[model samples]
Target chain A: MSPVLEVRGLTAGYGSLTVLRDVGLTVGEGEIVVVLGANGAGKTTTLRALSGLIPAQGSVVLSGTELLGRKADARARLGLGHAPEGRGTFTDLTVDENLRMGGLRLPRNELPAALDQAYGLFPQLTPLRDRAAGRLSGGEQQMLTVARALMARPRLLLLDEPSMGLAPQITANLFAELRRVNAESGTAMLLVEQNAAAALTIAHHGHVLESGHIVLSGTGSQLAGNPSVRRAYLGV
Target chain B: MALFLQRLIDGIGNGMLYGAVALALVLIYRATGMVNFAQGEMAMFCTFITWKLADHEFGLGLPIVAGIAGGVIFGFLFGAALERVVIRPFESADHLRQMIVTLGLFLAINALAAWIFTADTQRLASPFPSGALRLGGVSVSYHQLGVIAVLLVMALALRELFGRTRLGLAIRGASMNPESSRLLGVDVSRMLMIGWGLSAAIGALAGALVAPAVFVSPGMMQTLLLYGFAAAVLGGFDSAPGALVGGVMVGVVQAMVSGYVPAVGTQLQLATAFALILMVLLVRPQGLFGRVSVERV
Candidate 1:
């Protein structure tokens, strides 16, 4: 089957400072692809480029449509949902309102169902619905941010560092929830993370991005067992 | 006691006018994160527009209500267009430069109004009935009551807009974080324009309402602007509801100080507003109803 996402020769950078050079990758239908990288491996830049948050030179095909030259919002309408790093929650807004904002581009009729799905997925959020998002704990905020991205009902979800600053237990729960989401909803995910062992357990395919280049690629178990990956990322 | 009540009502009546201008400030501040220094002048311009439209020969000669409606619609379009044309270009610039641009706008708009309407003050007919409601020998004009009623209604309408509507969510979302809002498929620029447009419409209404009392002219809003700024600062520059409370407080304090405080005297009435503003800033800094912004890791 054709991949849900396809990037060819992706090159992105800030002004006068190139970070990602000629990177390429893909995520097939309903698959979880983890892009493992260190602190400055251009992992975040890759997601930003694909989501059209920053200017980049590449051919980004979502499903079948060419995604280049489109604005970030337009790309979102075309079924790309991004839950950015550091829990990109609207702190001032209530949890319910944050979810509403997440489903902002969905058709009016689809919003209710999407909201129901989000609430059902994160039952802890149901009780805290009216509370301002800023007051929520780190785990709850992360859940809120992820749930919010899911509200878009995207064909592919781009998650940047979902485990950063999360406790080990919270990160495990988050990954488990992500696994359930992938298995049940068939939403393809391009998860960029430094948490290799946790990411590998859920990821169907894994690629190690080093200095903006894909240096390793294999099945999840293969990357997880590799000595270099185990030393560099898994820290085992 | 009757004299005090009269003074209180009189203070509230004028407070409502200040509140209207303060609402305009809060609206623009919420959307764009910068105060439009030209907001008062924008209102002054709209008041002139209302005056011309209500003129017997030079304009449509519509009734006062119709003229004000025309002015509001015109103001909406004018403010929205200005956001797109004049403000949007420098929106990405630093706040200081943007503020300077608005100050330039203040000067330019004042000049434009002076050139078009001349420097003469024109009397605007009040749509409210010319009468007073007498209770315990305290006479309250219908016009004063009408101003307070209109301001309350505007506040209620604004509350509904921000609380229950999808468009309101979009506006709030954009104001909070344009980057995330864009990812959610919101057109941040368009929302900002709407904010400016709505603010202008409200400012126009304020201009028409105040015009009947002070008379419309190029400089009519000069003093009113100071009061409006004081109200916004006192209420918390970012809070709509704060603007209402701040406005009434400024008005009452000014009125009472001028009336009863022998040391302050009527001549130092403006000073009273300044003093209140200073006190609030020193004590709360966030204003009465403003939430102190919390940054997260």
Candidate 2:
């Protein structure tokens, strides 16, 4: 089977600063791939390039469909959900409205059902549905972002820093929830996490990135066991 | 006291007209996040279109109502086309540049109106009844009440449309996050066009309504635009209710202030709106309804 997403030599960045340089990675269908990196290592840039949020050079293909030059929204309509850094929820909008926006890729008739599924995935969002997204706690907002993306029924979820700044308990819960989502829906997720040990625990494949390039790639277990990976990222 | 009620009615009549214009400003701001400084000029220009259709000089043989309907249609199409051709190209540009473009439009449209209409104020007839209704000691013209009623309906319709409809959801969604909206297959550019279209159409109606009161002149709405902008800012640039309240409050206070304060003559009336805007901005930078956004670093 073809990989759900293929990134080959993808290089992109902000103006005058190249954050992602010739990065290569792939997430096979129904697999959770983790891109583990320290801060400013271009992990976020990799996702931004893949989702067409920034100018990118090189190939980013989804099931052989070229997505290198398409718009961020166009890529989204094609089932690439970007849970950007800071969760990128519409702060002024109600939780329900935020999720509905996520389902903009879905048909109007199907939106209610999809929203229901999002609420089902993250039951904490049910009560906050009528409240502004800004009112939610960070962990709640993060869950809302993930749930909102899932409303589109995206084939690949590009989640950036899902565990960032959350309490350790909340981080553990988020990882468990993400694992459940992948297992139940067979969703292909490319998670960028700072917490490498927790990330490798759930990720099927792990790629360690440094300065915009993938410095190491192997099964999660292999990277977790690698002394260098343990020292630099996992802190084992 | 009786004269006060009558003055209040007159103030409300003017306020509702200003409110419609302010609502237009709010609508465009909600969609584009930039105030259309030329909103009044655009409305006035369309009012001239109405005048051209109704005038015996360049008579299209259409009645006043038909001319108004035509003006609305033209306003919608004109706004959409202008946005597509002029504004869309500069969407990612700075706010100052955006404001300047609208200001440029203000001058262009004003000059165009002057060239066409000869800078003379023309009397336009009101479609509403001319008879006055006496409540206690105050006399209220049917036209004044008509303006208020129409303004209320337009406000309600807009509120409902933006808050309840699927298209509205998309518009709010797109305005909040254009990138994400596109991901969901919403045509953000098209929505921006629709936003401008809707705003200018309302503005046209306001122009037509107030034309009867103020006498249609090429520069008629310049003072009115100041009030509208003030109302928009005071009410929060994005809140419809804020616009309405601010418009009416400014109108009534201006009338009352000019009337009560002997030194504050009609000449000083225009300054009050600007002064109020400064106070509001200084006191609460976000305006009354604008929720201050907190950025998570």
Best by DockQ: 1
Choose the strongest candidate by TM-score: 1
**Candidate lDDT (C-alpha), each:** 0.90, 0.86
Candidate 2 RMSD computed on C-alpha atoms after optimal superposition onto the true structure: 2.3
User: Best by lDDT, which number?
Assistant: 1
What are the DockQ scores of the candidates, in order? 0.62, 0.44
* Tens-digit lDDT track of model 2 for B104-157: 999998999899776988877787888999889998889888889989988999
Q: Place model 1 in a CAPRI quality band.
A: medium
For model 2, the superposed segments whose C-alpha errors exceed 4 Å read B180-185, B282-288, B294-297
Candidate 1, residue A121: lDDT: 85
TM-score of model 1 (CA atoms): 0.96
DockQ of 2: 0.44
Q: If scored against the real structure, what TM-score would every candidate get?
A: 0.96, 0.93
